[model samples]
Target: MNLTTKILLPLIWLLCAIPAGLVQAQQAGQTKDNPSYAALADLLENEQSREKLINELRTMADETATQAETVAEEASAASSSSRELAQTTRAIAEGIGEQFTALAEVVNGLVDGQVASDEQFSLAGLMEATLNLSLVIVATLLVFMLMRRLIGPLLYARLDNWALHGAGNTPVIRRVICVALAAAVDVVIVGLAYVGGNLVATFLVGESGEQTTQASLFLNAFMVIELLKAGLRMLFSRRYDGLRLLPINASEAAYWNRHMALLIGLLGYGVMVAEPLISIHISAALSQGINTLLMLAAFMYAAIIILKNRRRLAGIIRTKAEQSPMATSKISLHLLARTWHVLALGYFAVVLVLVLLSPANALPFVLFATLKTLGIIVVGLLLSTLLGQTIGRRIQLSPELRRKMPLLEARLNSYVPNALRFLRFLVLAAVILLSFNAWHVLDLATWYASEAGGVLMGRIIAVAIVLAVAAAIWVTCASLIEHKLNPETGTGIPSARTQTLLSLFRSALAVLLVTMTVMIALAELGINIGPLIAGAGVLGLAIGFGAQKLVQDVITGIFIQIENAMNTGDVVTLGGITGTAEKLSIRSVGIRDLNGTYHIIPFSSVDTVSNYMRDFAYHVGEYRVSYRENIDDAIAHLQNAFEELAADEAQKPYVLEALEVAGVVALADSSVNIRVRIKTVPGMQWAVGRAYNRLVKMHFEQAGIEIPYPQSTVHFEGSRQGVAPALKLEQAGERYSG
Candidate 1:
């Protein structure tokens, strides 16, 4: 029973297990084949990949954060640098602004007349200054008085005696020393007074007191004026007969003295008192008004003086021009006169502008500029005059120069005054430039610092120096040539071949020098000399190609000249023409024929030349006599006639050798020819031949020698007709008979 039951239950369980297993196996198969199951597995793999991607992203984000922080720190540093640069720029701008503000304040002060308030004025200071100034003045006066009393009379006497007795006999050095001593006496007195006054002032007052400064300036100005006055008096002495330093007429001297005194007084007052007072006490408007009034008064005075002396000035200029031999000097004097008037008007205009339009501070600069310009002009004029006189006197006094180049000396001496005028103009230009610099009209310092200005100025100076050197070389070479080729010495005669050669050499040297100078100047002026030189070479080559005949002519002429083929006055046969050589040039020979026709023969075309009047010449003559006359007798008579000709005083100089008869030279049908030859000096052959002919003729006539004409006897070979035959026969018979 257990086996059956167990088997049945086992069967039931096995059956249930089999059904469940079947269902599970079917589901597994379905699940394995479904698309959704594959999708789920892929989804699981995707989830794992996404987790790894997230971790990588977190690492990248941390690196990005670190980089951002570093960038922000760099940006902050850049901002700090920009702010520092801005601060530096602001500081520089502020500095420039401060400079401009200071300049503006100075201008404002000048315009408002507030400059003097910078310094305080006190009664105690004024009192002390007054007392010190009085003491200085007294001391200066006492010194001046002592000098005048003790030294003046003695110096005056000595000068007077020297002028009366020793001036003419004294050496130039001694005379100059004496004149200098005489002129310096008054200067010494004034100098001593000034020194004493300055010493006293410096001792009494400290160096920086306004009153002391003003007094010292006044005293210095006064001393200068006195010295200038004394110098002017000494230069243009009031006494017409005294030893004067300047060459001026008495009336001119007196006029200059009066004008100079007035000018000096005005200058002293303006410099010492008026300027100080205007600066200290006057308002800008009042100072301008006062300055305008002073300028008007000075202009009026100067204009009146100039107008009054116009005729006198013209006369002086005319006289000076007349004294100079050069026409250029006359022109220069006229130009100077016109320039003087223009300068005066220009000065007046400048003063007017300064007083009316310019600020008060600018007025002082204008005044100072005017004074400096005037001084420069005066110094330039004086130097020009002195240099002109010195050069002229030196030229006149130099015996060697006169002997070497008389004509050149004469010509150069005439140009001395004109040269001086040019020098004065150059100096005036220099002074004007300096004045412009002083007046701040031009920024010369800045301009000079620039490359363009510096290079340009250097080039200009180099060009000037080159020109001057070239001129000096030319002058020296010309002088030497003139001395060597002096026509008066017979060395430079037109007839001399040496002279012609020298002339050509001189011309060629001058052209070479000029060409070299031009090239050098162009190089100095920053020109491309290499290209210029290359161009010149090409041009020269073209010229050489084009002017081959000219070059040939020149070369041939040079050889001819070197060989001494012909001279200017030589009678020569050239280019199939016989004439006297009138002129000789580099490439041609000029000849004037006896018929008054002139011919210039190129050396290249001249194949040959026969100079007739070189050293000696032969005079030959032929005399024809009758066949009956004796040849020996005629030759002897010709010889006698030639001897007589040679014995004559007029023909002796021309005869270098005695006349010789060659006996019978030829035998002719009508006469026998006898040739006579005589040697004579060059250019005298024609005269000697003529004289000989005349003498021979006279001697032949006295000897009864007859000259015969050509005659011929002919015999007919055959008879043409009966009568002609008869006449021919008769003629033949007569010939036979003869």
Candidate 2:
């Protein structure tokens, strides 16, 4: 219990433990080998030694921490993508090389008479299956051929007659139907072949393990190859002009059809049957190698065909394009001609590479891409043909219809050409997307099933619906306005005011519709349109502030129009200019005066508008006669002139009523002035005024009532102081002596 006792106990335990530890530590070798651990033995022996050991331990910890920091830095750098891309690329290349070498070895072994399959090869079974499939195909062909022999002549004859007669009016629909029917027949023939193959396989080939597989392979190859050839035949029917979908001549069609059919058949049989059989009976390696070799050969053949015919076909296509009636179609044809060879070459290259890259599983990928591409082309052609027929190459509106809707035919003419081009672009985009989908470049189907895709499609549909509704409303309003403006639309001639008001209304409607459509479309597209509207309001406020004159013009113009101050085609005096109101807009009015000078006057500057053509105009003629003439006689002559004016057929319609003679209105120094007032039709006042003036002058002279001329008495002011100054008017060149 004493402190000394505790210390001694601790010392005794330390001594005992040190000896045991020292014995164990001897196996760890000399102190120099592990000084740090050895220091532990001297921990309680010396203070200096303990401090030294502490220093050493601290130094060792520092070194360890530094090494750890270095390692962490290296790891961070490695984690970050700091390495060159070539490294991963090299790794992949090496992997493919190793895999390819291993496959090559397997294939070589098979070639060296070593089969890696569990079952022995059966050449007899293969031959028997092949023979059966051949007989099936032959029987199927014979059946179709006999049927064609019976019906083909009639079909061809009908197609020819239709094409011959249809071209003058329409031929695109006829061509499409003919091609589609022929293609269907070709497909049906292939169907018959497939059925015959199945029957033959059941009854003729007989079933066994390897035999069944072999027979199935042949049947599949026959069906696939025949169907593919059928499509090709539809594209370019041999010696059948009516059935051919392409625009090439019979010889060119026959050549392409034969070559393409052969190539397709070769690839189909090899890939579908031969390779599969080889893989099953011998080894997969051999099958893949054989497939790769066959694909390479086919690629070479296709390359040759494309290269050899490239220029020739391009020239032909160019010629066709040059002769095409539609500019859009011509442009499309030209582009196709320029790029088709490249596309074909690229397609083949891509297929070959894919097949080689994954020989075992590339069959579905390749077949799907090929078939999808063909289908897209066929469908596009059919659609184009249908569209061409529906929205014909040339649209001719009836004279009555054109007259009724004056602008409609022009609008359609302009719209159709651009629509054709736009539709072609849409078709091209669709084709590209479908092709990409088939190749798994982009999985559109997968996207369409996603939430985001659903939202997008819904928004698009909604926007389209909004646009359609807006368009319908606009068309209705426009038609109504047009009917009001057009005299021939069963509505009588519209007044100038009506025309001007309707034009302005149409412009306002367009602006309103566009604004509404855009806002709704944006909302449907998941855009927050509240901010857009706010921004627009702010912008409008800014514009209103900055363009006060414009606003004033518009406001004034509106008020002016509402008040019936002026209308288009009205002869109005505005802002000190007298002219016809030629063009009336919301902001300004265009006026052309009698002097042939055109003026654009903003309504804001118009203090007053004087429309000379309103209701009725006045033709006030003032007649001045010599003082010597009788005022009563002159008045009588004026009455006579009015009578003559009323009798004239050309001036009678304009002069609305009997002329009111304001008798002896003015008595001047040399003559008496009589004012005559008459009412005339609006805008015809000037013509009536001119005719009345002429009649008045003639009547005044005939009645000896002279028109006034200023007369002066020449009594010299200097002669006032003298008696009556004698003044004589003499002719020129007379000399006078004063």
Candidate 3:
């Protein structure tokens, strides 16, 4: 009904009927009542017993071989006499019948044995299935190989030539060719593996020529291994070529070295995967060990080259820094040290990973361990490179520092960057290891060693040592900041007291963080941490009560910080103490008084705050003029002067707007007073008022307006002496002079 059945029907019938017709042609007596033949016939008793019949017929072939051998021997003895030969033939017939009966018994035992065995997966069934599958696969591959070897090549040849003609640079064509070649290789290699596996399955259980089966299995395995080797070599070769095309020459060289190392590593992996399967064929442990060592040596040599290169760069950078010391950062040396440490760690990681993933080999393991250690040392140099570059990008030195250390510029610019990159690599390594653990491919306990019981106590000690070193560093940094901010009691370093407090605060915080981190890390390592947690809690509570003022200061400081009421250089009056603000820190506020004395006030004491620099200010004063001067005239003069000053080039920049006088503000005893008010720049009110006063003075003098002063006239009549005149005048207008 289907195309496959339609096509296969005729071929099947022809092959089957040919064998049937031959069997039919045999005479009835000649067909023999042999038990072996009867057993074979019984196997085909039902349509479902086709496989059983085929297996039985194949078994009968063995009996036929034995019978033929006996008949040949008897005929040889009777070759000289026909009667003797005929008698021998009859004897052979009786012998053949007996042999056939024995074979039938054997066949029945085999069938019974198969049935008696656990039937989860039958060797007989597997053999039959494998043989059938192999036939189909082989036929399909035959057609595929023909197409690949013939039509595929032909098409490529035409297309490649066409590509060349169309484009001078035929990179596309080259890529296509490369891809095609790779694909062809993959097809052939994988196809062979499939075929080899199938054939081996058939030979193990199928009823066939034992010698032929063994031979086929051997050839199939050998071919598969050869194909795998060829495929690996092809892949490595292409990768090597591709590595040469990178933009950076150094990077390319490094890549090539690393690439070769990886290839060698892959070779080691192959040997490991293949050795168990092929151990029966090749049992030479010494030879296998040698090959594994050789592969490891290749990678070790590559790592050495990369490490050596990194070290050389680091040394060059250091030399450059020394030559131009002014060019490096203030923290250049510190960063360099960190870089070295990280690099060494990374190098060790690479070596360790490679060795762990590789198969165990005696000489190779020793050599790889040595290389790993050496590589780790070199890793520090690599780390320094990135660190140098990163420092260069972030903190640019003052011009003076640059001039002081000229060679340091290049070192900072180059090595720092490499060190930063190395740090990133280390972080990535940790992440990758964690990811492997998550994936169940790696065990975290095994990785840290401290997680395992008993023997891991040494690791715990080492971790403690590391934590101690970290705490020391933290404390040292705190001490430095303290010394910078606050000097000794007798010392006259301004803000020394503040600096000392800040340093103490920082040191305390650092200690707390370090201690907590150590506790957490220990817990992760599965340490018993109950006492540590209790101690920390008690210590925290004790410190909390003792540093209540400090805590309050910090809290109040935080409010100030959040509100942004004042910054580094604002003038503020707080707690009735006014001064120009110098610095606003988390724990305290620094201010310089008007007398130039510095005050470090804790934020807790700063409940009331007055900020002077907000919005605007005012300049108010009273101006006087003569009573003889008209109010309108004085006002007109003041307005003119105010307008002129506002328009002046020197005053214009500071003046936000021109002044407008509010006239006739008050009437005094000596003069009609007028208040003139004007809006001005926020902080420029003083300057504006000053400039206006000067202008108004000059203009009022020109306008002849007299500024009135309190005066009185006294008169004495010369008659009757001064006494009589004083009395008479006092009684009259009360005009007197003294």
Candidate 4:
């Protein structure tokens, strides 16, 4: 490769590429006119077109670099020009606006506007507004001071006059005047406060000058007139018993007045009657309803206080009645007082409930109603019981009978009262039901499957479980005749009746517990038990058959326990075995025989158990007597010994009632046996038997009565044949025999 050739090769390639690019540009123009042709051209000439695009991109790069440098210089000059123009425009606009509005461009544009400096006198409006507000405040303070200094004294004088002249022990008219005066005072206070507040707000928002001062004065005068009107209305319309200053009888009137004042005050404050006087504006309907509720509450409160204080106020009535000309003799105050308080409280409570049920206090009212109902029930029950006790005490009866009769009296008292309460509750419940029915909130059909039913059933189940558990306990304890002296010792052991009752009770309780648990579980899963139980019955039958043996075992255990064939300490023998009875139980019987071997027999297999010490036992043994001894003398001596032994302290506990000896039980190979027997305490036979034997032996030994042993005779057998054969043998035999 030569340099000239390389240069010529490059030059040739450039020439070819430039013409090829030109041809491609022309082809692109042709294709642009016919898009279908362009697609075909692209597919066939893609390589050529790409080469052309690469050459064109190199040219574009060179052009873009030069143009970018020119644009950068122009942009810099334009930005500089724009900044200078913006500053000049801002300064000019601000200066012009300031000249027109006569406001300075203080820091952070606080006061920037256009106007002459002479027009800036408006700034003084701030101070003028302030002075006007201060004057209004001073005036309001003077009004307050005047009311407190003058009106308060006047009202106090009125109340004093009313009190001195008011009727004693009665709701007097003078108290009403006092209430009206107090209401007037409240209205004055509120009006003054509202007017002062309005002045402050108006000053804060208003500009100084005649316009502001004129507005302030007009508002002040209007507010003052409104306040005076409100005060006058409150004075004339307010209710109260305290103005009378009566001793005791002005309770109801006093209560009504105070509560009415409170209600009015509450409404005034809530509605903002003065000073920026923003209306609550919830709705006219809502306002009317609330006012109605407030009125009702006022009445309810007054009634409640009256009733609650009835007893305290009763003396007023008595005093007045005594002072009256018509009353010659004293009245029976007891009956009137008794019924009055109860009736008043009851009526007041009912009214209170109604007041609470009003829309404003629905939830609180419902809760209070429930509490009140429960309280009434409880108080009624107590009152009935008290009445019963009073009557019972007054009636002629023996002291013991009277004391025992409390339970009967209580039951009787409880019966009628509880029944009446229950009936009342039922009526209330029916009303509630009707309310729900009217609301259409509950569908009768779906209620069983709904959340409400779930909650209701849950509470019912909880109460039922508690009652069931209580009933089970009662039944269990019913059978247990606790020996009061041995409560601790006997606690571990079941009484006969206890075992019977506990078994039945526990079984029933267990079944109920399981059923309730299952029901609760299913209920949580949203399953209704009414249908579930029906299905379960079918399933239970199948399961029951499959588990018959288990059922039988449990049933057998229950019956054995119920019958109490064996107890913890009882000794019983069973199943062809002979052993000392150790334990009798529901599941099995434990036995330990003479050989000290233990045996356990199931209750089912324990058909015929021999209880060794069922009720009592006998201690029987024999004493040995010598055959050589005189039988009558020995018997008499033994009898004497037996009597003495019975008197013995160590052995006497085992003797039940008597001890006797049955003569000559047997003639043994070594000694004659004299049988003796005695009735002994249960489980005490063995100890008594051993003690008796010792006593008999010692007595016989002392009496010199020997216990005979085995004795035999020996003779020579050769004597019969030896008569002729041997005289010596016969002589020897005779000697031996002798």
Per-residue lDDT of candidate 3, residues 291-361 (tens digit):
44544566566557556566654564465556432333324533554375455545444544444344354
- lDDT over C-alpha atoms for residue 216 of model 1: 66
* Native-to-model Cα distance after best TM-score fit, residue 139 in candidate 1, in Å: 7.5
lDDT of 3: 0.55
Cα shift from native, residue 242, model 3 (Å): 22
Considering every candidate listed, which one attains the maximal lDDT? 2
lDDT of each: 0.70, 0.77, 0.55, 0.54
Q: 518 in model 2: Cα distance from truth in Å?
A: 2.8
Candidate 1 lDDT by residue in tens digits, 435-511:
67766787778889999889999998899899878877877787777777776554544446666666777888899
Q: For candidate 4, give the lDDT.
A: 0.54
Tens-digit lDDT string for candidate 4 (608-657)? 75655667888777777777778777778767766876898987766776
| Per-model RMSD to reference | 20.9, 11.9, 32.7, 24.5
Error of 3 at 455 (Å): 13
How well does candidate 1 score on lDDT at residue 57? 58
Residue 211, candidate 1: alpha-carbon lDDT: 34
CA shift at 618, candidate 2, in angstroms? Answer: 1.8
The candidate maximizing TM-score is: 2
lDDT score, candidate 1, position 123: 45
Clash totals for all models, in order?
0, 0, 43, 19
lDDT preference between candidates 1 and 3, better one: 1
